[model samples]
Target: MGRAAAAEALTRVRKTLVSVPNLAKVMANSPALVKGWLALPGALSEGVIPAPVRERLAIATAQYNNCEYCLSAHTYIGAHVAEVDAEELERARDAESFDPHIAALLALSDAIARGRGRIDERQPKARRAAGVADAETAEVAGNLAPNLLADTDNEWPVVTPCTHN
Candidate 1:
C-alpha cells in the first residue's frame, strides 16, 4: 500500500472502538489537508515568528472554532515547541495572561476565527510593539485560515483528519 493508505490503515486498526476517528486517518485521505498541516510546522519553526506567539495563535484559533482536537494538539505543541508551561497554556486557553505579544496574537487569531478577517488597530499596534511586523502579522493571519475554515459549524469542508492537532 501507499504511505498514505498504510497510515490510514494503521490509524483505523489502532482505534477500532473510538468514536472520534484518528485525525491522521482523516488527513491520509486528503492531500490538501495534509499540506496545510505540514505548512504550519515549517512556518512556525522559521524563526521569523516566535514559537510562543505561533502557539498562541494556533490555540486561539482552535478555541474560537471550538475544535477540541485542535485545541488539544496546539496546547501540546505550545508546551513542546514553544516551551510554554502548562500553566501558561491554561491561561491562554482561558483567555487570561501570557506574554504580551503572544496574547495579542491570540486575540487577533480569535478575531479571525470568529469571522473577522481584519485585525483591529489596537491589536496590530500591540503586536507591533511586541516585535511583530505588519508583514509577519499578515502571515500569521493567513496561517490561521485553514483552522478557522475547518472549524466553522456552517461550512465543514472535507478536510483530512489531523492526528497531531
Candidate 2:
C-alpha cells in the first residue's frame, strides 16, 4: 500500500481504539494507567518542562518508532495543548533545524525508546541543562516506558487513550 493509504488505515484503527466508549471502559478498569497518562499532561502544564519542548520530544519519538497513532496524537497535542506553533511543530515532525534544546530532548526520547530506560549519560545531562530536574526526568522516563511499549505492541489503535488512576 502507499504511504497515504497506510496512514489512513492507521488513523481509522486509532480512532476505533480511542473512541469514547472504548476508552471509557478501559479507563474504568485501569485507573492506574489513566492516572499516569494524566500526570504527563499535568506535568507539562505545570511547567515541569516547557510544553512545546515536551511535545516536540514526543512527536520525534513517535516518528522514529513509526508509530502512526502516536505521531498524529502528539502532533495534535503539541499544537493544541502545548501551543507549539506550526513552524516549530513541522520542524519537530521533520526532526531537523529545531531549537538545540528541543533537538536534545528528542535525541534523549529516541534513546529511551530504543534502549528501554538505558539512555546514554549525555541524555540526562542535556535534559538537566534544559532545566529538567532528575525527578522530573525520571517521571518523564516512567511515563514514556508504557507509551513506547504500547507503540511497539501496536496497542495504540487511537490517539493513545489517556489514563488517570
- Give candidate 1 misplaced runs (Cα > 4 Å): 1-21, 129-131, 146-165
Kindly report which residue pairs in candidate 1 clash with one another. 23-161, 24-163, 26-160, 26-161, 27-161
lDDT of 1 by residue, 87-141 (tens): 8776666454557666666666666556467555676667677786776777676
Per the 3 Å backbone cut-off, how many clashing residue pairs does candidate 2 have? Answer: 8
- TM-score of decoy 1: 0.65
Tens digit of lDDT per residue, candidate 2, span 70-162?
A: 766677877877798888876665553357655655656667767866887777777777765665665456445434424232233244332
The segments of candidate 2 whose C-alpha lies over 4 angstroms from its true place after superposition are: 1-27, 94-97, 121-136, 139-143, 146-165
Per-prediction TM-score to the true structure, in the order listed: 0.65, 0.59
User: Lowest lDDT 10-mer window, candidate 1?
Assistant: 151-160
Number of the top-ranking candidate, with lDDT as the measure: 1
